[model samples]
Target: MNHRSLFRRLLLAAAAALPFALSVGDAAAQAALPSDRVLRVVPHADLRTLDPVAVSVTITRMHGLMIYETLFAWDSQLRPQPQMVESTTTSSDGLTWRFTLREGLRFHDGQPVTTRDVIASLRRWMARDVVGNHLGARVTALEATDARSFEMRLSRPHGFVTYALGSAVGQIPAIMRAEDAETDPSRPITTTIGSGPFRFNRDLWLSGQRVVYDRNPDYVPRREPADGLAGGRVVRVDRVEWQIMPDAATAAAALQTGEIDIWEQPALDLVPVLSRRRDIQVDRLNTISTQAMLRPNSLFPPFNDPRARLALAYATDQAEAMAGGWGDERWWRRCEAYFVCGAPFGTEAGAEGYARPNLDRARELLREAGYNGERIVFITSTDIAPIGRMAEVAAASLRRIGMNIDLQVNDWGTVITRQPRRDPPDQGGWNLFVTFASGPTMQHPLTNIGTNMACDGRNWSGWPCDEEAERLRNAVLDAPEGPERIRLLDALHRRLAETQPYRVLGQVDQPYARRSSVRGMLNAPVMVFWNIEKSAR
Candidate 1:
């Protein structure tokens, strides 16, 4: 049977076994916290790292949103709005900007937040985040003007200063304590202290099993109501517990029995079963589509050759890949646009021949690249259902095009940790991996980590180095938002097509399932526990 059929069979079997699974011992019940005061959720992945600046993974980013706060945040309209900053001023030349912190901001350790902490946090974030790096390049100086204020002097007029600081995608600009922010950007900080509405319970953190957060009573939320990731972050629940459940059936059963309040990303195949129940509400919190891609390591052989990368692109069938993993066509669509389909910059500039599958052409390209059956190591996360399915589909497609594939499966945490290694495939390196990001994150060239083809190794994990692509991307960034910018974006898209930095598999909308009792959930790209209340069932 085909992968889609196999997935359907497995899902049906799981649904049939749901009744038996409900008898299993409950992990959340063991906690002493009151059910009404606690909001239990099955997170997308385990919280392996606490330092958000060091890792760009989604789970860590979500964790940071709970305990940390940013100077500014993206509102529902995707506009930058002040979160931590009370007031701001800009020089007439637009080369310098000053910001004053809001009053009553204190870290979880009971220390007042100051400008020094903001400076240190931004400095550390600048060394790691893609957008932060761009902001750092134009910044001449970032100094604390007073105990509660800071100023950033730019070498040139930067248009997206606030946007970069308030970005809701990828690695967020989470403000940290001065001492904790002093930690090297390359190393993960153990300290979890932050000034957000929730405090991470480090004592209750059980690595791969459970992660807990307590509401911070001392948090001073903005007066405005919650909008996206901006405005007031009111914590209604006394505690938020992220209970990790790798199995989709077990998680579904838990949600059914009221053992869990929410399942962040439910398996698409089982959505029908969950939706049939009135007690469970399946909602697509993020309206924007999530773009899935196959990232190939350009630093290694096979994919190192642009021709080989093109071969994989030609071999990929967007429709087949989407159906294999995402199942329902209602949630996924074939999108060849590298900048995300339906976005303003989204275009099929040069994706005519390669976007659709051409097995004969793929074989020809592989032969031209002089591939001699070298094993291509493809790492996948079994914990994330779609990722594993995408990897399986991609591996099968590569094999049909005569590529030797070595598929390795691991949990989401392990996959993320191993993705950074630049060693050879035999020495813990990976040739390809399947992952997805929100459309907002992939919409703009600057915010799109996949489009960052900087020759420096500091780019995204794939390490795709293309001078021409880099030049085109920089041109797009510099061009004003109009015909000129659109022209440059088209050029960049065409160049990326030729270089094949990464292959866009498809676009999908993954919904979150929650018990009807879980109320006040915000609709943002990343999950936020704040502004959520666990009503008595």
Candidate 2:
């Protein structure tokens, strides 16, 4: 056999041998468990890393939600609500903040959830998350006051501290045990201990195959009714199993056969077939739509030049990109706004630049910028269907703009993992990549990772540096939430467009499928398991 075939066989053999290596009890326990008590799901991607700081993929964040608890959480109405925190008090200057934990909080290991744990967790999160980093910048110190209370003293008053703790966006400040939380921010946690509604089953974790989570019976949910990601998080199912099915057809078949309870993200092409099933119910779950984006690396040539960036922006047709990415006409919308299209801060500022595809204008601009024949390394992920299609459309557009293209295709995990590297393209750096996030995640400046225009080239994957955009972003944070704040946001949007850090392709409709027997699923963007009950066929 050829080397490739032999490697494939060896890999498959190793995967099959993992459960056995863990111990025969692992496989037997999984098979012997009652199916009625377990909720089987096919997540969008595999649960590779447990540390929220190490990775921030949607699926990883979903897993973090299942295994960890935060101090605050966003409600259905997009308001911050107390989750683990009992009450928060801010001094008159808004610089001193005190938070007390709710009663009877305990980690999975039965250790009481103390203020030290909370402080340590937030400290680690502050080093990684953008919201946390911003909050940390103004903080003088974070200390544990009492057994259950923590204090945050800031150098200056900042209004987004409470919101940052409970943020549902990228790198949420998930609380963990003090020891586990003490792990270096640069490294993943050694333990998976958390105080969330579900307890992660470390023994049953099989990387690309399956991972198991049992209901945390000791978890003390809040007295209030469950909202978006806040309030009560009562676990209805006894256990939850995430079976990673890389093939869309296989997952669809599993869902139709009632072998799985929910499919976090079902392929659009197979939605029709799955919708036809009598036992299946398919519906769009995200309250706010999702926006696809093309992020250009500002450290590299071609994209680094504003004229070159504008050339690509002018050449891109959101309608065509949406059509290619999301096939159905009803599945996507042409949104040119930087913020969420239907959100409160949504404005058409700078949208005129992306109104249409002007190839002639794009070519002329490229020529004026002295377009050197620099190779553009475009990263694409085949594991995620929508992203793959979007990358294809982007590649076609760039080629048409007379640019050299080196399209590198890999899995979603690899794409995200490589986007952070700052090496030259030939030495593992990337020129561009396509990704997407829910509208709610991008609606507000506090949670939006895309709009962070840090002056130092130490921002998100693209690494775009614009001091004026950063200043406007800070201005929005300090301003009260009103029309005045929105005006500031519009100005920020215009500057961001001028900098060309990233371009929004369009908005897409994300629909999830579940068995008719499953009920009480929240209408939120993230795939939540709490409050959802599953019945046997």
Candidate 3:
């Protein structure tokens, strides 16, 4: 078959298998509608896990925001603002800090929000999140002074404590009930009770098929205007339902037929088709753009060698990958810099080495590294549009460099489950996978989960260990918010180029579609479901 024919076949197969991929029931569930006040959305992924604190997936974070509250949140300007906290005071020595909870806060279970709950939630979050862990290491004590007040006694001064707690980047510090927060951070919390604007309808959640949320009438929202992940979380709608439609074509058709009000991340190939519809409104969801990535496992052989990693990196063609993943070059840009282009630390300073593909160099490196004919397990989730295409592009690039590939296809949830396995490739472990993240997350060292060099084999999916990079990341955090911080971040980027833990497959602008009647969408870094209202046709 020709390349175009193959591409069409792949796209069609993905679409045909999607509607039934994660379904346990018949089409009757898709036809079920609660009421006119219900807002139906087709999310990028099905809600696989309910524990937002345990995992940092985009869909889980959205669900967390719907049910859980945070102490602080980021505004549109990226400034940290108080959300659950009514006031905070810091001592001159910076070693002591105090926070008072806002009045009239009540969890879905009717329990008043308390300082003990906040302390437990922070402890649970600090155990998992990188930023939280760093901050936790500096703290001498975390104590609750009263029913609504808490204090933190640190060993030294820390400037980014508030930002770390308020950040929505990865595994946000979502506040939960004290009992739920006391659960082990390594395990998922089954309970979903919080003081957010919306309450999770656990009785109606159908795992990988559908999830529902109802407006919390008793929950109190901030009086301030909504901005990004901060300010008021007013709920104008009575209900929000997320229906899992993995097929791009199916989701676009649903939007056109008015079966769904919003499609969070539409396939790039079908954007034009959706845009031509009069009732559909396609808008750029994330202005920072999405950074495509090729992650390789450093725990196993073949990829365990930096030379082997460099071989694959040399074989990577950002333009080819972007074209295959997101057709129409206008929708994507070739960003070779690992720190993302247009950010403060984003520069071409030391990225001249990774400008273009070098198949000859790749082969030479592979041979020098004594690469045997072992299969490189390349994983792809056919159900996810961009991820499936990206996997194909990366696999093809590696094959061109004379590497053996064992292409594995599965659902997105399965990929997420297997990405963290430490076993060998033969025993359910993964050697490589293709995924993407928001540009804002990768722009800085502290917020960038990809820059983690924990070396403990438990870093981000593809565990990379570079003591130099880790030290530089600390330097970036310690330096004041000025040019010195920028210098430190750039230095870390240069070190990442040498380490080659992962490769940037370019950047793509993701467009979200909603009904024309829906309005007041926020253009924040992460998708905000607040301040959006739907009117009857």
Candidate 4:
């Protein structure tokens, strides 16, 4: 396909779109159009589990925002603030830390939040890969100081420990009951229980449409004032009805019709149009999210050699791609850095090491890789705001290099079909689709890359298992967030880049749309809806 031909075909390409069908029924609207006092949260997908340890879905991430409270929560700036822990202290050696738990806290079951429960939950996540093998390995041991106090001893210093605790696994300790123990980690939470502001009525677990939770009156918060937010934020809403409206169109229509109070980014293509509308409000995350997409051609045919994959990856003009497909706006940018606001390890690579847009180099590499024209499938999911547009650019670049390519877009669910751990090929079937893996913890490469996803991880592509990658990954763990970390992470990212572990296209923006009535919309690197407590509607 010619570059122009590819553009024309992709820009106008349409997939089987599931109609976003949600209606603010007249019955509810006429029967006292439920007051703004009740915040109606409309998510693109339904929440999956109450068990914080294994809930990996977007809906689970959303529901997690409501039911669970972590030790340290991120503010608009990604700074850690107190949520469950009243105060925390680090040891002189920088390995052991102690957290003074907030008092008067009660789980949904009315059991007082205790140190034992936190320890148990932490142990569960670490022991069984709740979050993954990395975190479990990091935790040296856990001991309760008292009912409301406990200490975490780490094998190495973690600069982002506060932010790390904000992950689902760490937060599991705070949300689940001490007595609630399951034999399997992947199993769903049979009942929802947590120390957050709201408590769900247990009966709604299987309805698949709506999950209900009400405010926990006994809650006593340990205030950590937010920067942009005005005053103290305690949960005000008596009830929260999170509706799982399957389609974005339905969610958008519901929001426009006043059926749903909040609908996360209706559609990326339509953001500009929605921004012009006066009735609804748009909230963009202040964090500048950018990532490199590294696709591997070396694994399969046509791309059987390392040079072939490298040719495509290097040939990718990220600068233009992000602009053409994503946006020149702050939300998108040439990553250069491994992680946006990259941890200390980012310093090691310095400014020079990052992959810059190099068209000439790309062309040369493509030439070196043996330029026999062959079409390849550049696939991705249409769940977030940016991927669809990006797929077009990738297809364009390959076409520009005289490569024939077909673009395939799949739903997020279908793209990431899960299988048993023993079956890596079925997992490879999932690799047939394109998707992005957003780690709960970004600070630890050992945690993120080595354990959870580096070699043969769930959805890992090109079948990776590099011993050197495993070595560098382990070296960075015990290091602090300073120079040592910089050395490890920079090399890790660079190493992965060289190997073409998985095609890293870009770190796409996770856009969310909130109601005008909603207030205190904070931003973080994660998909969090906890600020719903601060929203008025």
Better of 1 and 4 by TM-score: 1
User: Which segments of model 3 are wrong by more than 4 Å?
Assistant: 1-36, 456-458
Ranking by lDDT: 1, 2, 3, 4
Instruction: Tell me the tens digit of each residue's lDDT in model 1 across 1-537.
Output: 555564456456556445533332244644555678888888889989888888788898998989999999988767899999999999999899999999999999899999999999999988888888878888999998899998999988877889899977767899999999997788889889999999887777777778888889999899999999998999888888788788887787778778788999998877877887889999987767899999999998888889998988899999988998898899999988998888878998998777679999889988888898999999997788888999999999999988889999988888998887899989999999999998888988889988888887787888888999988987888778899988888899999998888999989999999999988888787889888888787
Model 3 TM-score, all chains together: 0.92
- What is the Cα-based TM-score of model 4? 0.73
Give lDDT tens digits, candidate 3, residues 1-537: 444553455455555544443363334543454434678888889887788788767888888988888899888766789999999999999899999999999999899999989999999988877667778878889999999999999998888888888878777899999999998888888888988989888777887678888889997789999988888888877778888887666676667666678989988777776676789899987567688999988888877788888887789889888898888898999887777787766765565767799999998988887887788888879777778888998998899888889999998888877876678888899889998888877776777777788665445677888888888878888888888887877787787787787888888888899999788788677776778888876
lDDT of each structure?
A: 0.86, 0.82, 0.81, 0.55
TM-score of 2: 0.92
Task: Report the lDDT tens digits of candidate 2 across residue range 364-410.
Answer: 88888787667889999878888888889998998898888888998
List TM-scores for all candidates, in order.
0.94, 0.92, 0.92, 0.73
Candidate 4 runs further than 4 Å off: 1-34, 87-91, 128-135, 154-160, 168-174, 201-209, 226-233, 245-249, 290-331, 341-411, 414-422, 426-428, 436-464, 473-489, 508-511, 526-537
Give the candidate number with the greatest lDDT: 1
Question: Quick one: how many clashes does candidate 4 have?
Answer: 17
**Candidate topping TM-score:** 1
